[model samples]
Target: MPRVEVAEQPGVGLDGSARPSEDVVVVRPDAVIVLDGATSLRTDLPSGGWYASRLAAAIAERLEEPHPADPADVLAAAIRAVSAENGFVAGHSPSSTVALLRWTETAVDALVLGDSPVIAFGPGGPTVLADDRLAAVPRRGGGGYRTRLRSGAGYGPDHVAALRESGAAMDRLRNREGGFWVAEADPAAAYRARRARWPRAEVHAVLMATDGVSCGVDDYQIFPDWQAVLDLARRHGPRAVLDRVRAAERSDPDGSRWPRPKPHDDQVLVLVEDMALA
Candidate 1:
């Protein structure tokens, strides 16, 4: 059987921000799934956290049964189940990202939606299993080609420094116009954006994390070692990692200092190893 491990961190903002960590993860013999709720949009059904939690739980439960390897049906059912239970569709329209990596006896299959990435690693280093938005703020000057930014914390040094010096850039980073973020809501696009090559490789470990974690690293640094992050999580635990990230973002001298009552974006990671190979 496959082994699983998980960690979740809450962002640093708001009265009940600590209560609404939107990161979710699943570890099973056959697969691992990670879900990250969006940060911009709000929901009436208790808040964005409800949607993210319900969707993750529903999907995890569905995976317990035999189903198609495609994450689309899994997500579609999860959305319906959660929405029905919540009783109001629009009340919980927070968009979120999804990363699901399924391992079969002979091969591996995966899917991703909205930027939360899935990475598979081995001796050759790592390869991305799936790619999603992973960004909260929209790219500059609109259109798909522009570099997407994040709200509050997670801005690049130049942007952060500028925002710290002047309030104007902060406003731009938080702007909802030209396609800002909305948490836990169904992604405007499907999570099944790509497929992965799990069978051909001698997999060591797999990782999935939200933008909050990715922000700490460089864009070119995709698929940083899962073992390293997992080691940090193991030694310090998830809460500590979150606290450290919050502190770093809060104290970052770069002008993009996160304002008080910071948004509590949930952070989570899923780690797994191939049991058969072991």
Candidate 2:
């Protein structure tokens, strides 16, 4: 059996109040699943963490079933189950980013929705699979669009209205024509997720992470590259990498260095190592 290592940590909100992490990591005999629940801008709906936990549990259960099914189908079924149970409205409820990697002796299968990334390490090096369309949404010319939302900036009615407008604009693009996809109330988005397969022989290790950890590399430019993240996991552990990320965030408490929605978002990581090569 392949050896797997995992780590997770909840992050504080901008006010330094601790909350349950919305990120979830699940490990099976042949797969690793990572999820990042989207923070809801509105207060009337259930928290993103609530939706993520239910979805993650449902997905994990589907994966553990004996019957064989396509990864996309499995995810779709999970979404339907979660939505039915929670009565969540499509395009109006909390959602999550999905990253999954399932492998057999012959090949490795992958699926990615939203920004959570999957990195596969092979003899050729590391290949990173991520969906960046969410970030591609045009931002206002001034910086700190997300930072202002949660930086305790004393938002007035105009500020709140502007943020709501931005969110509505982004919503129109979700899981639609020329728009990015995610595992929300709609299951169709699962079929639209980025999918790939690689020969098992070509893959030596697989790392799945939510945006919290990946932002340290891709967004914050903390590490030199993806390989450095893998090296950090190999030397210390997944939690060590998260620790470094937290340390970096502490250095930039006021978003002057890195303007993000939250000062410290939840972090989750899973590393699957092929024992045959180890």
Candidate 3:
């Protein structure tokens, strides 16, 4: 069995209430699943966190089956069940990113369905499995939000409006041929996940990061590389990395450097280490 360590905290809602992060993590003796739910922009639809919670439970139930299935199959069955339960439509439904890691005595399987990334570490540095299609989507006003944020527009109504606009634009291309894909109401998206496998002996550790925690390594450049991230998490624990991310965001209060949707996002990180003696 792999040893797992995790750290997570929910981001505050617009009302400043303690809202749970849309991100969820499920770990078993041989597997770890991470989900980052999209925040809902519409009141009529269920919140992303709400959807992710039920989806995670469904995934957990499927994983408990006596006969194990492939990682993609697991996600597909869970998505199908949840979408049916909620009467979700393909393009108009709450969604979440998925990162799955499953290991057996002989091999380790990894899959990334969205921005959430799965990194495997062994002798050859670290191998990162990520879906970067979302980043390719254009922002409204030609990336005006980041500019406005850098120019000192805090999380006011204007920023909120920009988010809504960008979200709608992104939604148009979601799960489409050229846009990007996530675990939404479409079970087929699960098959579209990026997948990789490695011999168990080749993997010493694995780390899963939601977009919130990953933005640090991605945009903030806090860690030099994936190795640095793994080192920090292994040494100080995942919460320490979250603290670093939060501190950096605090440093750039107005988001002059890292212009994001919010000052802080839902932070979730999981580190699974091989228990075999070196």
Give lDDT per model, in order. 0.55, 0.82, 0.86
Q: Residue 217 error for model 1, in Å?
A: 1.8
Task: Give TM per candidate.
Answer: 0.66, 0.90, 0.95
Better of 1 and 2 by lDDT: 2
Runs in model 3 deviating more than 4 A are 14-17, 275-278
Clashing pairs in 2: none
Which residue runs does candidate 2 get wrong by more than 4 Å? 142-165, 275-278
Local accuracy of candidate 3 as per-residue lDDT tens digits, 1-278: 78899999887664335777889998887778899989888888999888888888888788888877988899999999999988999998999998888777788889899999998888877899999988877656655668788788777778888778777878899898889999999999999999999888888888899988999889999987888888888789989999988899889876778888877899999988873322
Tens digits of per-residue lDDT for model 2, 233-275: 9999989999999999888875557766567899998888873
lDDT of 2: 0.82
The lDDT leader among the candidates is 3
Ranking by TM-score: 3, 2, 1
User: In order, how many clashes per candidate?
Assistant: 19, 0, 0
* Candidate structures ordered by lDDT, highest first: 3, 2, 1
Candidate 2 versus the native: TM-score? Answer: 0.90
Task: Put down candidate 1 lDDT per residue, 1-278, tens digits, no spaces.
Answer: 56666667666433333465766776766777777765432223355455566777787888888655366677767766666675644323555667778776666667776567776776777677545332444333531111222233333444333333332332333213443322233332344355575663477667677766654443323325555565565576645544555555555432233332133345676666553374
Error of 2 at 183 (Å): 1.0
